[model samples]
Target: MCLLNLIVRLSYVDHTQDVSHTGRVVELKNYVRGLLLDSSGPLTKVELINHLQRLGVGYLFEEEIRTVLDAIWKGKDIEIENDLHATALRFRILRQNGYDASIDYFNSFIDEMGSFKACLCEDTKGLLSLYEASYLAFPGETRMDEAKAFAKRHLKDRKGKIDTRFEEQVDHAFELPIHYRMLRLEARWYIDMCEKDETMDPVILELAKLDYNILQASYQKDVQNGSFPTMYYRWWRQLGLVEKLPFIRDRWLECYLFSLSITYEPQYGYGREVLNKVNQMITLLDDTYDVYGTVEELELFTDAIDRWDTSAIKQLPEYMRTSFLALLNFGNDLGYDTLKDQGWDVIPCVGKLDEIARGDVPKSIQCYMHEANVSEAIAREHIRGIIDETWKEMNKEYVTDHVFPRAFADAAVGLAQRAECVYVNGDGFGRNQSNSEINGQVMSLVVEPIPINNV
Candidate 1:
């Protein structure tokens, strides 16, 4: 109904070329489902499930995959294949999919010294499987810890010594285990890898490629349509943050990708857009506190944010007025939207958070650095350990029911994962908005659509 909505969002992605793509996707999906239904062996079923998941079309076949996995999730080895690679792959996939596949299943391979037999070192696929699954272990799984160490030490040594094709995946898994990588992004990368894999099922691969592009188009449209970031960009331009403040900058893509990492399902557009706004706001406040604001000025800004009132803006510095007012407007808009849709006025729930008290001012990394009197590197290691611990805790929570919406819980974890991704090598927000890691990730997720070629 507005001028902004009038501007179409073609993004050079043509639907006419893809008119048959929709039909092909449905056709291939049914074929894959039939394979799941007819597959006679556990090995074939589990392997197909992994391919579906890694190729990103697994979501399309969730019901079939779930039904198959439920049938295959017998905790005993009598039903599963006896080999290390098959068993380890099943363990990792099952655990990841929320089944309590025990780490004890791997005890048969451990020797008297509690070390994984050197025989496993010769089994490259088995070692890779073990290495990946070890990361999924909960706290106090010492055997898994040993498994990781053993697998990692050998995998690194055997890196280039194996088949060139598998080595590509070895390098990928070594950089970051698939468990930690966001799904949609990982799928983009894996789709290419799966395409190159000679044994990959053609129908399934075609479905993955097509479904990815289809959902990707939907995501891009979300970026341009109702509750649009393009609309937000226009508002941001109107805000004149870069011009007036001369420090505030736009990070719409990064924020959107961060939100997508939270949960990329097309149905979660409202939640994704809202989460994008939250990320953008965090960027602005982070810049104000860390890059621009003086100690005294930050104190004033913090107080204004705490008060959540226009009256406080009267006492603030000239440059601070617009940022503070914009923050208030954001809160008000969210409150208004919540009421209009849900019939519940949540303005009362609006409250200022992150009022760090005294010694609590030091966050995890800083706290570890000061408390242990360790180098920054060591403190960073300590923080990574905390992240790993938190993940295990979340893994425990993930298997149980929670009161929070699934999206909320997912976004909470995704927020932490985004921080890790953005800041992994260095500032993902900084460095000209391009790095080999995030630049490639963003391109895969948003910028470049997968080529819609024939299978």
Candidate 2:
């Protein structure tokens, strides 16, 4: 019986491998796509789109989704009833997909007293939808700010009193808003939750499970097949930095997952490798500046990096010398690869900046606080503003095609997005499991594999 079990497991693996290589995935894709379009009402359609996005399979039906959204946009001028859930779902989805969805529709939800109607809290689902939609607010949307605060206060108050079904959802929303979640990780979480629902289509659930497992198997194989882990392990060993700087994080896996989040398609293997190496270097540099290196040593390192000269490493302590050289060599090699492959001199972009904080031993935020003579809270607000602007700049580069070879530009934006997502709560990658939000992300994406259904 034991032998039979082993044989069955092996056969299952082979079957999944065969299925991944066949037309079944394509068929499943269409099967799911049809369900998305088959929804009867606009509310149902928008909800389906929302589910597809959260499930991370929306990419497979991008064109169809766009058509539906475009139609919705054309009908935007039409006044739909102010049913909170439907209105908020339509508003969030529309704005998220680049439609000019006005928050004016929410005016109906407000009472004559200039507050959201008190009675609306009874519909927890509608309140939850409104809470989620509030996050899509742009600058100067005072209404959204009020809505968010109102929704949150009510949700927290009702946390214990609410039904068990709504309790988990409310807690999750409070912990991490959907706007900030990584797509694939959210999909994994949502798929598990969705599969148990009797209302969910079994076919869609099965396909989602199978597709996720297949990709996970591919990712597992990637780890075994590639030199990434080996190269990172050697670099960490050779640098001896982890032992030397115990305060710094030793998270090579998280760095690689950051790369995976940037571009998960197997075809972008080279891009992923490049990103992983780059992220590894950035991680080391962040730690060196934030924890290990003395201000003076950091100043020297900063100067050396700016000059892009190896001889400057002579001024560094013995502990710092090898890392400087390793960073320099990595940059040179990357430049060479980019030049040879894309005919682009990437060295200029790669060497454009180095971190040099003044008036603080550790954080750049401290420098801001010192310079501006503000409290930590004010300084953090300033930092958030800077991040928002940076995102705008990144988006501009993508839209205007300011960067050559769109793939690199997209990867650059993706890296920026991933960094913001991970660090939004705190320095998530500073220490593994330090932040539950990112820890959940790491576990979902890297450590855990999806359990296949109907295998």
Score every model by TM-score: 0.89, 0.81
What digit string (tens of lDDT, one per residue) describes model 1 on residues 1-455? 12233234345546565668888777887888899999478888888888888888777887888898888885354555457788788988887777877787787787898788888787888889888888778877778878888988988989778988889888888877877877787788898888788888777888888889888777667555545656666666677776887686567667767878887887877777677766666667766776787889988887887777789998789998888887788778989999899988765444342232212334668778888999989998888888788777776665567788755665666666676667767667665544456556755775577876657
Candidate 2 segments whose C-alpha is farther than 4 A from its true place: 1-22, 76-80, 231-248, 356-427, 432-443
Misplaced by over 4 Å in model 1 are 1-11, 79-81, 223-227, 344-373, 434-439
Query: lDDT of each structure?
Result: 0.75, 0.69
Q: 1-455, model 2: which lDDT tens digit per residue? A: 12123224333343346455346678878877787677466766787788777777776788999988877777643334458888888987876665657778888889999999998877777888888887767656778878888888777777778777568778778766675555576678788778766787676666666666666655545445534444555655676767875666667666766887778765666776777777667767766776788879988888888888878988888777877887788889889988998899988666642452222354768889999999999999998767655543443344352438755664565566576666766766665534566556655664456655353
Q: Deviation in angstroms for 278 in model 1?
A: 0.9
